[model samples]
Target chain A: MRITELFDNGEFVVTAEVGPPKGISADHVVEEAKTYLSGITAVNVTDNQSSVMRMGSLPACVALKNAGLTPILQLTCRDRNRIALQSELLGAAMLGIDNILCLTGDHTKMGDHPGAKPVFDLDSVSLLHTACQLEKGVDLAGNPLVGEAPKFAKGAVVSPCSDSVDAQLAKMERKVMAGAEYFQTQAVFDSEKFIQFMEKAKQFGKPVQLGVIIPKSAGMAKFMNKNVAGVHVPQWMIDELAADKEKAKAGITGVELAAKVIKECRPYCQGLHIMALGWEAKVPELLKQAGI
Target chain B: MLITELKNKDTILSLVSGKVFIINCHGCKDIHFPEQEAEALQKELAAGGNVTGIFTTDYICNPENLKLRLGYHAEAIAQADMILVFSCGVGVQTVAAAYEDKKVCAACDTYALPGYQGVTPLEHDCKQCGECFLNLTGGICPLTACSKSLVNGQCGGAKDGKCEVDPDMECGWERIMRRLAQVGRLDALKCPVQVRNYATDDEVKSK
Candidate 1:
């Protein structure tokens, strides 16, 4: 089902971020999605996530689709040029992958293959525009597709916790104008800041699914704060995570923290995109504790 | 103008098998020359009697000026086994193409000078993405300013006004927002959706 239909029906959407395997088998992700993330609005399969070469997203998405699951096919501008990108989108559409997540993607410099060429053929906004054009039956060159036009519910990503809120809002307007039907924000840790961003971002009138990353431990929180862009783990949360010196129980505490934030941030967003970050089994527990 | 910096002297010497003629493009003079660095290397190389001749030229990217400048160096260039260029990539390519029969090498490596610059003045890079976002951005060029060249807006990665990719570099969009607010043109950030002209974007990505 398209996320728009979920929204139109007033469903509080929930999604999970899943990475395609480095090898060919999509069975692990498929099984994981089924066992732990059964109720998610859609399973998002990332494209060459973190610039590490992986099995293509479409294969994994197709596997999930074969299992009767709605999959958001993630497309990034890092590896593919416009031609490859559009062709991939068309392929996904033909394969019944209706949800599209368009991203400018992380630079190759940050990825496993720093030497790989970073082809940002189109930034996220332009890609969204192009996706809409394709859905409207015309490609970027204004040429019509020979077959039936593929339809998609194009989605964009945002960083509500960006240092420059005004600039972010400015971009939100562009994304919305570019035909971004929905948004999934970068991992957000600060609800106050997220609330502030949401207050202004409300003007764009698009469904924003806030990302809630579950930090497994104080060490993880600190690492995220220092390394991850757009993710700022607050001192209080770190202190709370650090209080669990037992470490074994800290993972549970981390789920509780994530759930707590999700509860607090619920009103500000149309959905919650949980990024368990390898702690997938705990997501079910986190949602349960959060009373979702 | 292009910024040029001298390459490692050891590497240059290793590449120097025979007589070498050098040309320095001072067109971007006073910007980021590494002139003293180049001269220091030259002084060391000249001590070996391997350097045939050396001269400085301006606007070596200009084909006509390049012809006039190289006209004088024709003899030295012929006498030398290799022609060493100290300029940006464009000037180096121009020299290599002009001297296809000669062994041409770049003695200096060019790095991006943040924002676009020209022959007349040194300003921030424009990227010339064809669809300028400056009018909507209070004259700040997001393509050059932002580390990712993300023109839509600032990414969430910046912290303490620093870029996510490079901690030392200030976040470009933060600067733009500050400037926009300073000029009371914050609304200008949304004047038009900054979709780069497809024709121009294709050209940029091809490189």
Candidate 2:
């Protein structure tokens, strides 16, 4: 079923992210994704997430869709220009990949290739607007389409942990106005803050999926806290994971914390987007532990 | 005016540890230039007899003007082991280019002061993020004015038109919408937001 259909049918939507491998082969990642195919509503394929040059999200999503799974292809403005963005949107639609998540993408300095020139030709808002234009059978320059317009279930990212909630909300409003049908927020650890965000986001009257990350270790939590913008892993969680001596037991604690967060936040959101980092296989266990 | 704070004391003293010549720029006319801070530090350095000479010049960003000042201080410039620049980045680059052999370094980080109108610094700042939305947003820049630098509408973080990040500041979008309402151009908000051409500035800079 289409992701939009799942949302419309009032199925508590579940989505998970798939980071394309650094190299070209998508076979292993696609095979790993199949294990949880029955659990998630859709799988999000990242576009060189963290500015690392990886296999393009398009082909990976195509691979998943070919394997009989719904795929949400992430498109970041950091890599492509408007022309490429519009062209790829149509291309993805042609290959039966409809869902798209627009992002401004992380700056190039955060990636493995810091020397690479950043091409933030468009921010997420403008990309959404362009997607809407393509949906209407026109190009960015208002040129008439030679063929049919692509149909896509457009989505965007929101950060509830933004230092400026007012500014972030204002940006979300613009995204909504431009053509974002849904939003998946950045990974949130603080339930109170996420709940507060939901209280305000509810006013937008759109389907929002809360982001939850499963950290493998205390070192991972601290690293994310320091490196990732808008991701806050509380000190107590860090302390709890740090207190555990065995790494395997710490992994279990991290999963439990993720499940606890999911249980607490599920009421406020329409769905959950589990970003396992690299631990995608354990999502079913997390779902079971959360009693979802 | 662009604000510039002096570099940390340790960094400045270390750079000025050897025979040093100071070049203070009056370029861009930033109201926040720390003349007192520079003077106090200079006095301390002179008390220890580390100072070789000090010179002040306007338009140090212009290499020709800096060259003239360098000519006047040739003796001290030749004697000094290091040239300490208490100016903006542009001035530091200028001094460094003039004397390629000397170890030239900045004593103050240069901040871009926006609202340039024939050399006057305005309170507003423009990040020049390739795409200009100033014509649409009532001349207030969302790139610099908004905390998140978000191009879309406001996030839920604003309360009573004040920014959630800094309550003292007005929300950029709120201000845009209010101004648009006043001008009866609220329809502009509904227009397709343009994709920013990040390459625009890079191309310009390269040229």
Query: For each candidate, how many residue pairs have backbone atoms clashing (under 3 Å)?
Result: 5, 13
| Local distance difference test scores for all models | 0.77, 0.75
Q: Which candidate gets the maximum DockQ versus the true structure?
A: 1
CA error at residue A235 for candidate 2, angstroms: 2.3
In terms of docking quality, how is candidate 2 classified? incorrect
Q: Per-residue CA lDDT of candidate 2, range B1-207, in tens?
A: 455557667867755547888888766644357889988988887788767899987767676767877898899988887778876544565565566556666676434445542352334454534334544454445666665565555543454556644668887777766655554445555555655434433345233
| Cα deviation of A39, candidate 2, in Å | 2.2
Which residue pairs show collisions in model 1?
B115-B124, B115-B125, B116-B124, B116-B125, B116-B126
Model 1 Cα lDDT, one tens digit per residue, A1-292: 6788887777788989999998978899999998888877788999998878999999999999888788999998879877898999988888888899988887787778988887776778878988988988989878998878888888988888866666677777888988898899888878899999989998888899989888877888888877877778899988988887675254777887788888889988899888777778888888888778
Name the regions of candidate 1 deviating beyond 4 angstroms: A247-250, B1-123, B126-133, B197-207
- Could you tell me the TM-score of chain A in candidate 2? 0.96
For model 1, what is the error of residue A6's alpha carbon versus the real structure, in angstroms, after optimal superposition?
Answer: 0.4
DockQ of each: 0.35, 0.14
